[model samples]
Target: MGKFWGKFLRSTAVICLLIIFAVNYRFEMKKTIDRFKKQSDENYYAMEKDVSAVNELLNILETSGNMYYKKNSNIGNHNFDFRYRSKDDIYVSTDDSHRLIAGVNKISSNWAVKKELDMSEILSESYKNISKVMPDIAYMYYASKEGFVNIYPEISKDSYPFLRNIYRLDFVKKELFGKGNKKEEGVSWSDVYKDPLGDELLITAGAPIYDSNTLKGMITLSLKSNFFIKKIDNNLITDFFIVDQKGNVISQMSHGNEEVTSFYDRLPKKLYDKRYKFSDMKPCDIEKIGKYYVYYEQCNSAPWRVYYVTDMVKLNAELLRGNVVFISIWLISLVFLYGASRRKAVVEDSQQTIEKLQVMLRKSDREVEKDFLTGAYNRKGFTKIASSELDRMRRYDLDACVIMMDIDHFKKFNDTYGHACGDFVLKSFVRTVVKNVRLSDIVGRWGGEEFLVLLPETDYKGALLAAEKIRKMVEREVFYYHKQSLKITVTLGVATLNVRKTLEKSVEEADEAMYSGKETGRNRVVGYQDIMSKDIKWKK
Candidate 1:
């Protein structure tokens, strides 16, 4: 009976202690949530103001943009040369125009060029006129369905490459007004996107021009991503993000030096995909997703959603340490400090997870063309990019060359050493090739132990010199496989792309020339045109 009584008392004490802990946890969580919600209210107001300001600014640009098209549609000649062509065929007239920079995806008739250039000039004048009055807009542009794009705000002589990048932007190709959805009526907004040539983040408001029910082009106004970010971000408060309909970030607050990427990757899929239905209502809060307290507002004006995320881990413990909540303040403070340290660790791990998501995001698109092992272009990617560049070379009457090289006795490395050593050799070989090539040049792994190199503005002689230099460097470099040392040589075939031949034909020619080198001598450079010099007969 004495033992039974003792056991019962101890059991009762343990159960009472657990109940106390449960109550404390509940109280603390409620207090933290209440405080977080209040802060979110302030954040929502600030962000709303920011969005409104952006809309207002866009409205002014829309007015200016409309005026450009409102003017005469008739073509006017200002003696802009139709005979002029840029080297890459990516740019048209950049240096000549002081206030307007022009680029084209491909050249068209002189009549079309005159028409595009004339409209571009009018747009440039409108941008210039507006700047004198309202110095608010950073830049304005017009993108035609044909290929022409005029970016106002004069690009310098050497900065023409930047203009070309703008012309080749994905938005220019597909979503001129963020037209992925094509939801809005006029002056639709582009999903926030980063500049391919630089670090600057930008979003565009574009108004499409229609000619009797046929879609023409768009007049776009550019705004920095910060124009939206600066409004709601407070380091002491919640983190903010402007997410598009597709869960792409339009703008975001600084989260240290870590780059902000796809928002869908950061949160649970259902948050944007399913869970709560977003309506054209007031800013609303989502109680919790995982550990984050989220609130969002769908902009009635724009097709994007604004999010405020409150990390429960970062919440202050002032409420838990208050006189009403705690009898021993310092003791509670010590416990809170300990908990905060653990939460910091959780936050660090979360950041590492986010970094991994960034890699996953890149894999979805960019990696489709990328080689998994070597980071070089795979066959498909190589074919696409090389074909484009080759077409440009042929059309613009510029010079380029192709080099098809294969490892001499590459099978020996795999058979004798092992596939691991073979892979190491292949990786090392690619490194050497890439290091020897110019930044403008492209290298691709056509297949196992065989690679393709595209050199822009390179003649046959230059291509041969480059190939020999690559061969000599590769021959001299030592390879390591554990204790054993190995060296390898490459047989390269050179072919010029300036001729009126397709990319496939040129690649075939280069491949044949490489085979000729293998037939004649194992480790030598050979040119397709000089196949007659060798005994091997190459089919034209």
Candidate 2:
């Protein structure tokens, strides 16, 4: 009986120790999790703050650079006055130079060239002042509408032949003189181009010169790729670079004799393997690769993305260091407590699995059907749903209508406000339309800034009313981005399905009507019937 009493006492002591271990283990685990969560939030906020600061700096610089041209290019008379003269009056003719000259002259007014304004001293002094302010500016120059270039801190003539007739290049033809470009007031940012002279990547920022309504010439500033990298390379937690909307790297720091322009070859495989529709990426979304965390933020004034990459292995190392003691204690406790907790853990696991399954089922439809950018229907999903509804309507001989709409001056908006604002505008547009339309109506993204609304069981008049409501809502909506308010408008075309028209043909007719509205004036809705009365040649 004494032996049995001793065994009972020892068992009681062991059970007491187990309970103590479990409580301590749970407390430590909670503390560790809370600590890490706090650290993670701090780091995330720090990163976001840094990104915003850098983005703001870049925006200010670009804005100032553009304003420099607008203010300086209106020097004197409307004449293309180039004061800097070559040391030797040596002239070389080439097909490229001739084409460039012709391109520049094509945009110039009929006014004769005047030698009256000698702004050489002004140009040289302005360059000196600008250099003091912006040391990264490698070169500043002015080009005449006749293809003559006056470069500050002049170099030998043999070094830059292309500068002599810059208008011949596609950059001049497309960016500066392209259709729908407001040449005089607009600034153009060149893609990363290989510099023939230095064999390095370079980007040119230019603004057109204007006298009243005529294109006189342009002022340009060139910066090396390294110059941009230096501006934001001070951070240790993340490394970032600029990329265009198409995911092509614009300017990045070169490494160890690697060619800076070999973006597709040298960039992360993930960037090249899949296209980033950027529209789908949220501001706080962190994409995880094998051992890296990728974050991107859009520039407020450019159609470019600033991508930040952090090494997850390095991040985890910092996280784990703080939790070592807790982890060890937890592991030891787990061995002793497993048998006691096994049944309870099994029940919890089952419950968690069922809950996860239910959540997955609910999210699957949204994942499959929604557009990544605007949360609208993707093209394929929309087409399928719309076609099915159209088929059912046809069988019942019910009336249905569709509208095609596009944001007016969207490209201009992007150029002026930056791609980030463009994204904001798109989301706002979708939200406005969705709010005004019936819940039964379907809105889908047809393409960039283009949307299609499927109005089931609605007539042509109803569709027009819906379209007009959307148009007015967009115009009246105050779009706020980065503390600035912007106004935008849309043009919509309405068409109703008839027994004679297929569902696809009805969509096409609506698209055509939208184009007609665009041709006449934007921010208005046009009905297909209105255009059908006229002999209109629709663009293929």
Candidate 3:
């Protein structure tokens, strides 16, 4: 009877100890879980907003293109001065010397150049006023397959050859243009990149321009790559960061000391590989990998999984710091009597380490400065060196001229035959100019049916002579096609830049002369000097 009574007392004591273990640890677990839940929720909404902002930037670009298509047709030239550049838009150009004023808004036979002014205006406004729409947007750009990259909040050419480098990224080809991605996910975060200007990492989210299922180009916006990792608090989450799908840790310092970075290396493959187990819209998951207690959740905005990890042994020691006697009694009760261990303390790490994911993107081949079809300089390539050539002319007090040419009624050919025949005629026209002109003269496709010729060391008369020769040759050449032998004529405008003036003013004068020829007969050569005849005249 006495032995049964002793056994009953010991049984009651064991039940009380079990209750204490569940209560103490469960409270700690709940606190950590709740904290992680709140942080993840905040990050999810922020990421959604950022990705949405990038998508909106594409809309702005397309809207501007549509606006250009609807511009006033009667206006001979769409002159948008860059000096009156809006406060909101950043001025980005291949030629920094001409950055102060726009010199190339000239109307051509094609709609391509005319709309650049409208795009520049609207893009600036989008960047300036979008502060109200999405205040966190610091960088955004539209990268056209036509070889132009328009970025807001001007980037440095020395620091970042943005136009050349941006086109060569894998993200631009695959992710933005939709090869490996589902259509429902309209925009997606790119693998992070090291910012050229700073130590920080950046990520891109953008959409591509598709015309009836044909990809035209892409537009993108950028934000910090640590969007998810920033949610980790050093005091609360000592070993917290984000990892890519491959389990590479993207560690960035979140206003903490630099010493913290070297503390933890890459995250284990065992953890990130198990990311699928943490279901979306579910509770924060708690897992033990080796000696570490890991809490994790998936990010909705970026292609990353966020994690909070701490050493289990260290956490228990810290938790038992204040409850020394209670923990002692609890440990003794469990180990000596019950043959169980006390609930290990649920606590954070003693020191914090942010693991940064350094994404090394291979520089794609950047051989796009020249025109792909015609082999002449495209506008982008021409603009890169045109300014320096003119500056040299000015420094030497030598004569130089720019000739603007356009094929008269070129669209009728595209309408009559298919676009293929029209493309053939353009190639032939370029061939004739390159064949006849001096080796020093530069030829470039200005836009649509419009083309440009740079005459170095030439007066208006010399340029006119050269322009007339090209005009006569183009008038004579026969485009022998299988369907029909087609004939075309070109109008030429010449402007002399011996007098001091901006390139835009000279190009504007040249464009004006070209339009005059188009207005009169369409096969003649006109000189800006002969028309303007002001203080600036034809210099020999």
Best by lDDT: 1
Please give, for residues 1-540, the per-residue lDDT of candidate 2 as tens digits: 997887787677668766876776566444433333333333333433433443443344334434444555443353232222244333322322111111222223333332202232234346666666556666666565554555554544466554534555556566445634344454566666665445565666666654445554556666666655544432223455566554556665444222444444545676545435334554434565555565644443344555556564545554444345444554455544434543312113445544643543342122134565687885656888887886887788887888999999999878998887888889988999899899999998876788999998998888888899998898999988877988889999999975567878988999999999999988899999878766555643
1 against 3, candidate with superior lDDT? 1
Model 1 residue pairs with clashes:
none
Greater-lDDT candidate between 1 and 2: 1
All candidates' lDDT scores? 0.66, 0.60, 0.60
Across 409-432, the per-residue lDDT of candidate 1 in tens digits comes to 998989998887888888899999
Candidate number achieving the greatest TM-score relative to the actual structure: 2
What would the C-alpha RMSD of candidate 3 be, to one decimal place?
Answer: 30.6
Identify the runs in model 1 with alpha carbons over 4 angstroms from their true place. Answer: 1-35, 56-74, 77-85, 90-98, 105-119, 125-139, 156-170, 175-185, 210-216, 235-238, 254-260, 267-283, 318-540
Candidate 3 lDDT, tens digit per residue, 184-220? 3255556666554445666667666543344434556
**Candidate 1 total steric clashes:** 0
Each prediction's TM-score against the native?
Answer: 0.45, 0.47, 0.43
Clashes of each: 0, 2, 7
Which wins on TM-score, candidate 2 or candidate 3?
Answer: 2
- Extract clashing residue pairs from model 3: 89-124, 249-357, 250-356, 250-357, 251-355, 251-356, 251-357
Error of 2 at 288 (Å): 1.8
Off by over 4 Å in 3: 1-23, 26-110, 131-138, 160-162, 175-185, 196-199, 210-216, 227-230, 244-265, 268-284, 310-540
| Candidate 1 C-alpha error for residue 506, in Å | 76
